[model samples]
Target chain A: MLVDRLNSTARRVPTWIVYAGLSLPAPWLFWQGLTGGLGVEPIKALEHEYGLLALQLLIAGLCVTPLRRFAGVNLLRFRRGLGLMAFFYLCCHLLVWLVLDVQILAQVWADILKRPYITVGMAGFLLLVPLALTSTDRAIRRMGMRWRQLHWLVYPAVLLGGLHFVMLRKGWQLEPLVYLGLVAILLLLRLAPRRKRVAAHA
Target chain B: GTALVGLAGAGEAQEALEPNGWDEITSYCNYYEFGTNKDDPSRYAGQLTTDPWSVTIDGLVERPGEYSFADIIAKMTIEERIYRFRCVEAWSMVVPWNGFELADLLDLAGVTSDARYVAFETAYRPEEMPGLRFPVIDWPYVEGLRLDEALHPLTIMATGIHGRPIPNQNGAPLRLVVPWKYGFKSIKSVVRITLTDKEPPTAWNKANPREYGFYSNVNPTVDHPRWSQASERRIGAGLFARREPTLMFNGYEAEVASLYEGMDLRANF
Candidate 1:
């Protein structure tokens, strides 16, 4: 019954409202960074917050298919918005690290090349660029089956994002490991056998 | 060298020092005994019991016994030394510490001729330290220094900061402050000091040997595996403040460079 109620509510809520709601934290976090609300090292805190938000959005986007199949709560319309927002947050995360944290242009390249975690994070960001570019309804209709195939890149991109977080920490910390575990479970849910639809003619 | 003399004199010169704010120094800490978060120490360190503290002095020393904090303080002359505090994570602060030189304490203990190293250990009360429950590091947090380094004039055992008694989060009763080395080398809330012949295990080195080395001197040229050591962010330096270029031996090269003479710093680091 709760699932039914959630489905009904989801239908009435415009997808644009979801975009508007999720985007509110972006400006708020920027304000926090400027006003010392993020403590003494606001740049580092802001970078972490943005990266974490991107990962969370990616995980939420992953859940759409599973929720629809298992609980019949269709959120197909919101999937593109969720994905695009995740990419937007990911760009914010990268920009913070580039422009604010590591200001030196040469050092940034050095980190991307030498640091394994940075390399993995950069790869994930690169993977999402094409997805973000092809997210429009017109582009989806133009490509059709190819667009579906292209969007599957999100699975590996999100996996790398989780791994990047796990490696970023000093040691085997529980928080990053928990994020990686959640991503793995969501990806696994896709492997379950699909229910066969009954044919009326047959 | 003349530069060495000038720098040594500068330590005692009555120059107006710009130390970080008390709140910044007290709140932003890396005392992992409380928790991993920067504010964790400020939040949870209140539970630590610091009064009536005693330090166990043992190993190749003439005076090897449990010395009360009050007795140690009474025997030593306290002074203020403003020094640059640099963390291995590429952040730094200027701290005005109140304490006597560690060399004076070593002199009181009378280190034996064969003693080559000095080892220190932090208080390990599991009931008081919640962070100890997780094996973030090998517990009882240990650190060590060469006998010469331990006796360096710049190395001090700090009891207070900014003319007041240190907060529980900032190693209340006693802590080591080796200005030239990384901040982790300055073990906090020390309870044991041992004079030994061999190099003792340090917490960060044991946690990840590749990243942390025994010497851990603040060298700009040598980079940590994950990050650069060339520049450091100054805490409380505002959101848009540019990072300052880190100095070799944290600008104490005049006094400390001789300690590592004829040795390769990059290899040692």
Candidate 2:
């Protein structure tokens, strides 16, 4: 009954509201970084915050299908917005690393090539590029079934994102490992078979 | 060459040096005994009991015994030393440390002729330190330096910062300050100083040898495997502040470069 109620309420809410609400944190975080609210090392803190938000958004995107399949919650309309927002945050994370953290242009390229964690993170960001480009309604209708196949790239993209966080930490830190573990569990949930609908004749 | 000349006039260089604010020095720390976060030590280190402390000076020392913190302070002549503190994470700070040369303490203990290395151990109190609950890099953090490096005039055992007793978060009672090496090499809340022949295993090096070498001298050329050591961000520098190029031996090349003379720094690194 709660799931049904949630679904009914969800239909009345404009999907743009979710986009507007989620986008609020980005500017607020930037303002915090500017105002010294991010502490002495604001750049590092800002970079970390953006990366964390991006990972969280990716994990949230992974939850949509399972929620619809099991809980009977129809959040399909907001899935695109979630995916796009995750991409947006991922861009912010990458930009912060590039423009603010490692300012040297050659060094940035060197890092992406040399560092395994950066390589994995860059690969994850690259995977989302096509998916984001094709997120439009026209592109979705035009491509049809192929669109669904293309969007499945999110699975590996999110896994790599989680892996990046794990590798970036100094030692076997709990927080990053927990994020990676949560991503593993959510991904495993996707593998479970969907329940067969009962036949009307039967 | 210019930097070397600047450092040659050590007294004048020190006068020109501006130590970081007390807030920055005390708050931003990597005392993993307390916690890993920069502010974790400040938040959780209050639980630590630092008074009435004693250090055990053992392994090839004539006066090898538990020396009370007060006795050590009374025996030695305390002086202020302004040094550049460089972390392996590529951040740096200028700290004005109040302590005597480590050689003075070693002299008090009377180092044996065969002692090749000086290994230091941090205080291991699980009841006081929450971070110790997790097996983060094998608890009871240990670090070591060659006997000569330990005896170096630049090497000091700091008791206070900014002309006041050190805050618990910043290794309250006693801590090593090796200006030339990475900050982690300077062990914190030191309880034991053992002079040994064999090279003692260090905490970070033991954690990841590929990334953290035993001789983690602040050399910009020898980058950490995970990240570049080419440039460092000053801790209190503003958000838009440009990263300054990291100097050889963290701008203490003139003072410490000869210690590693013939040895290959890149290989050791």
Candidate 3:
């Protein structure tokens, strides 16, 4: 019966399950850092690790559709889990700042206002808040076509987020630019000729 | 007064340590390196060396002696003075600093007539302080104060906060705490104090003079090149809460506003 269950959907890409499996390490690592089970300065490393993971997950979430379309695989399943992981990491990033770093709302707000990168980063996070809030199947179904429209905000959010990292640097560097390029490509995908035709048809 | 630490029995000796209005003052920080993210310092600050820290007071001062953070702390009385800390970037945090006034230390050092300004420098360790690896700003972080600015009644060479010892992340042992100026003006983890006649160049000013000036007083009217400084979100308050108006000198106007009366604050800023 198990083999039959596996065989029935064997050809289908279990992308969501794969993404969920991939996200397991991120939270486990973050939890370890939060609980002081890790090495010296666990909270410190956790902050960076989670933030980087969040960005990487966002990048991977974007890549899922492209990879699936290009590689001829049914990978829509993975997109949800990977995208949710991005949301999860973003939450952890916020938590590290809220709980361990600033620990105060006023200071956090002040920091968001005082620093440009912080402001942009926070704006990016703010944009994600609504998207994450409505990411569920129920909400997506309820919202209908608006859901896809709203999800488009992620394009700018990720772009701004990449810009936030670059601005934080004292001088222009290559790493942040690479992230920016990924965001650009992700956005460029939206501008594909097929996207235009699809929108026209809709 | 190291003995003041032992004076635990004394209660309500001073004003209650009021929060300056940050939504989360407990986590508000001034560590410039570690990427300027509010939580970045929590990760990178552990690498900083706070023990056996000393400041060499030289230049125009007659008593140019190296004072260990221990000697500096024990000698002065600890007071819980909540200060409004405004960063040059435009955010503000009201911190309950624990240390005596800078006047106490200045009097001990005995500044000479030639002393026009006091310059502060942080330890230059590129290896441990990870932010130093990239020249985010000029190395050996610097800050300066006019003689009057240094002697402001509220200025304190802060050693602690929230009625307890300062955590290493928040400039432990010794740091210049100037509530009236931007947060960076309150140089942290101080290593050198030089009294010089020439106006000293600060870290930010050296990195980008237009953005940072020597007399970086907390000003709401003057906008930083990148952003506005008209208001601030008080840390420790709930998220999305109403904000308060930033004061001329962090609401210490009664004591410090007069000091900058004649000077062109716009130019100075």
Candidate 4:
């Protein structure tokens, strides 16, 4: 019944509208920032805030399937959109860090090598690239069942992301702990049942 | 001097931690978006228009008025003071500041009898400031000190660094430079200075009170919420871990420690 409702809604909502609604927020946020609506130093804040939002979206994208089974919110199809948005923000985040933060090529690569957290963060961000590239309908059809297997990289991407946050923290703090807990619960919910089924069959 | 450093020749440049001195501090910086990094501020923030920037002096003042940055710079003679800036995050830098005494500015403002503390506020335009959205610190960045602390000779409002006007990324136009406290205590891109009877909530302290205290004096004893406050990575120096013994009161023990006499620095810190 929920799927039927979602299908009907999806049919009624034009794809262009969906795309427009999805893509408008970032540029709009950036524009509002340029106009000084956000506060002093709009561009810097816009970039950082969007980057944080992107990380949050990556976690949310991973949670969609688990949420559909557990929380009864079957917004699973939105995962692709959310995932794409995450990659978009990651691109922007990387660009800003490179352009504004590093401002030099030699130091940019040096920072990635020298800082452990940056290394993990870059790993997390880079892992999303293949997933984003193979997200298209044609790519999904071409890869067949392997498409699902390939996309499993999202799990490690999210894991590395949480590790990035933890490693950046010098001491135990509740924020990173919260992200870690959510990831653990997500993995357990998806994998623990499969393990139990295999054991029962044996 | 040994009582401060425990070494007879502690002030003498010693064979060191990571080798290269004057290397990292110039390169790595957390100046947010408004100020230039230690090295790039002069290059990038050079074109910043500070002549039109006005500072509003209000709060517990008998006479409140607006003063342009240029006028303020012209009113007082800037003296060169080489001071150590210890960050709350456990990094330290020895910067030579060209600044005027805060006492001169406070006197010009005619601070009232009720004014017991001086609060500073940064420009809140995110369009210009870009980093305001998620300031590794907080919005409307602030710093303050008790009236006595404000009146201290070492509490100066810096206009330039390294004998030239401060670069944009280094809080161009005007900023506070309190040698006795961690570097964050020196507020940047200031637009407002309010004299208040009650202590103002500072940016770092409001973000994490346990880590950032009201009196962020440089005492080797009080550790930050994350790292050791006893010592710091002197940036632009060789090696990642190279460090030197931190001074008590940031080497301003004689100039400023009397204000906290009989008070436990550990508790106050």
Candidate 5:
């Protein structure tokens, strides 16, 4: 009975509501950053927070299949919302690093080209560009079967995102390693041999 | 060389205020021997046993033997000094340090006429300092200063902070506090004081010679290859607070600048 409710009326939960709810944190984070709530290094703190939020949403977006398969709860309708929210956070993260942290265009360019961590992070951002562009309903319909294949880009992009976090830090740390581990496990679960891939059709 | 000679006169003195509270001093640190994280020292330095510590005074000194921490403290006259501590990372704090001038200790050791530099070595217990397990830096951290610089009244071997025995996290038993140069030059948890004829290789300079130079004086004009050195963020200042313009020799030029004399700061840096 609960499954029926979730599939029918629950699935009809407005996309605008999800968008507005997720957007609420952006202004709060900006206010904190501007008002001295971010501690000693506010720019660094804000940059880190934004990047982490992006990674968290991306990981959450990847969990839709496992949720449906194991828990018998299909929340596929919110997958696009999660993905768009992740992209929005990623843009904010990159903007803060570029405009606020680095400030100099030459230095920003040098960082992307010279630093291995920045190079990988830029690659992840590049991969997401096409996925975000093709996320619209009209584009998905027009692209048809090709859409699914193109969206597989998210896998490599998410892997790079996790690797970026790990490499950006100075020395070996537990938090970054845990994030990398979660990303790996989620990806491996998707690649595990399954009969017919029911979620692909659904 | 001409420019160096022309700039022989020292800059004017500047005022520096009291340091951040004890909580900030105890919590934040960059002790690579413990770990790279700012809070690692506070979290892990408790494992170090400093009560029974001893410092070996060797090299060109007359007294070349291990002296217990207790004995060293007993022999020295303690005084409180408020000094501005500048880190290479472009952050600063003014801390109240309780210690005697290092010149008094050198006098006690009777430095040999051949001694031109004062080399310092930090404690290296791999088991206690987990960061030592990694090659983050060459173990047993080393730093050095010119003889004149070491003998300066400003150079102190700190025993305590804020009138309390220095916490294990803040280099408990003993540490050098050379207010003019960057923080790393003031080596922490000192275990050895070697009076040497030649300039000693510092831990950071040895690790990355290009980035970290031997005479790491705070010069705002000469920017680090990675970042600007023109300004510094004051610790305990609110996050959004504007970074203050960095001072040459960290505003201690009035006292220490003449020591460099005609030497090129860029080359020596």
Candidate 6:
């Protein structure tokens, strides 16, 4: 079948390539930031870009199941890499906000408590931690079925990430709303009857 | 030190000790009509037509008429005024604006005695400003000032910046510059001015009243619903620079504080 052939082909492609490809934007952004290419408040520009990129990668990781089921294209081999990269970018985003934007460690806690967007974003990051740590093949072998259950946390994490973006914007914005809708639709796709067909195949 | 000395020589003290570079000022702008991103305005605002502009002066004014931009400039005595421009978003810049006081324009229009407020409106061209297509702000952005505030010597109707005609991204033809209030209060690319007895509706206030108050004075004490207003990052400061403590009325309190005397700033803010 085409699905078997595609899965074999996707597996041959080294997953490290995904990491190398996704990592390109960081150096470019750093260069732009250092050279005054980022217009007023470079740190803010950098932080925003990192956060948005993380959200995009998380969405891409979520697309793997829907794509395999609906289109018979298997990118499951690269899914773990995509998820880890997303977590990496999210860490960069959080660190930038903490070290550069806020600076004061004491105020960071105050901000997390006071600001709804920060609270939501921090919650999202915390939820993603277990998924990222358990992304290894060894963890999958050890945890077995329990591993999949824990990794399901990606749904709430991605949703909270989208909600964090929406809450941070100044007013009613179209882009953030669209992102939230996309995340909702991706999550809804997983709850469909096709899940039973996939489980039976497994 | 050199930059301050040059400004001091020009008799423009009380300017930011380190004024923003001309490139920084021009490149970074928050003209929401063009877009929300700071870079969006500089990229798109060039398409905006500023020539052959006319401002409709109406309401409680005796000499109500559409005054051409050329005629207005010809009639007014223009001079350079260095002022601190503070955004409600807790960022600021010291800009050298060239224009006449808003009081001069009010005088020319012959504001009626009953008029208590001066309302201003920005040009709303959907074709030029793609942001207008979205409901980011009410089209034809409206802002207002109290009559006394309008008449304040520091309140200017700016036409130019950095010793040249104001760039399109920075409100090309004519823009109000209420130095003591948050930047949004200084409505840009003005097309209409109305003197009224009642307080005029402002764009930000109409959008989110809970967050953006009608009287968006630069008070460090009163915070925005989501963010602290106690400190602001100076625009030209490099990436590693720290935020400086924001001052009351953005450091113009000595000049404009009495205008709000006996009023509750917390409530108004």
Cα deviation of A35, candidate 5, in Å: 8.7
Q: Over the stretch A101-140, how does candidate 3's per-residue lDDT look in tens digits?
A: 5555775777788878888988998898898889788998
Best by lDDT: 1
* Model 2 C-alpha lDDT per residue in residues A1-44, reported as the tens digit of each score: 99989999999999998799989999999899888788788888
Ranking by lDDT: 1, 2, 6, 5, 3, 4
TM-score pick, better of 4 and 6: 6
Candidate 4's displacement at residue A2, Å, is 32
Error of 6 at B55 (Å): 0.5
- For A1-202, candidate 4 gives per-residue lDDT tens digits of 8766765675565444434565676777767765655433343455566667677888888788876676555665677888888888888778765764344577568667766778888998888899999989999999999999999999889888888766655334445768877887787778646555689999
Greater-TM-score candidate between 3 and 4: 3
Residue-level lDDT of model 1, residues B146-165, one tens digit each, is 99999888889999999999
Error of 2 at B86 (Å): 1.1
Please list the C-alpha lDDT of all candidates, in the order they appear.
0.90, 0.89, 0.72, 0.71, 0.83, 0.87
Candidate 6, pairs of clashing residues: none
Candidate 1 DockQ, CA atoms: 0.60
In terms of DockQ, the best-performing candidate is 2
DockQ of each: 0.60, 0.67, 0.08, 0.04, 0.24, 0.58
**What pairs collide in candidate 2?**
none
**lDDT (Cα, tens digit) per residue for candidate 5, span A55-163:** 9999999998887876667878889999999999999999988876666688689778766788999999999999999999999999999999999999999999999
First chain TM-score, candidate 2: 0.95
Q: Clash number for model 1? A: 0
B177: Cα error in model 5, Å: 1.7
lDDT of 5 by residue, B117-189 (tens): 9999999898889888877667788999999989887789998999999998888888999888988898899
RMSD in order of candidates: 2.6, 2.6, 9.0, 12.6, 5.5, 3.9
Per-candidate clashes, comma-separated: 0, 0, 34, 24, 0, 0
lDDT of 6: 0.87
Candidate ordering by TM-score (highest first): 2, 1, 6, 5, 3, 4
* Backbone clashes in model 2: 0
Candidate 4 wrongly placed segments (more than 4 Å): A1-202, B1-27, B33-49, B135-137
- Which pairs clash in the backbone of model 1? none
Put down candidate 2 lDDT per residue, B125-182, tens digits, no spaces: 9999999987768878999999988988889999999999988988879999999899
TM-score of each: 0.94, 0.96, 0.64, 0.57, 0.75, 0.93
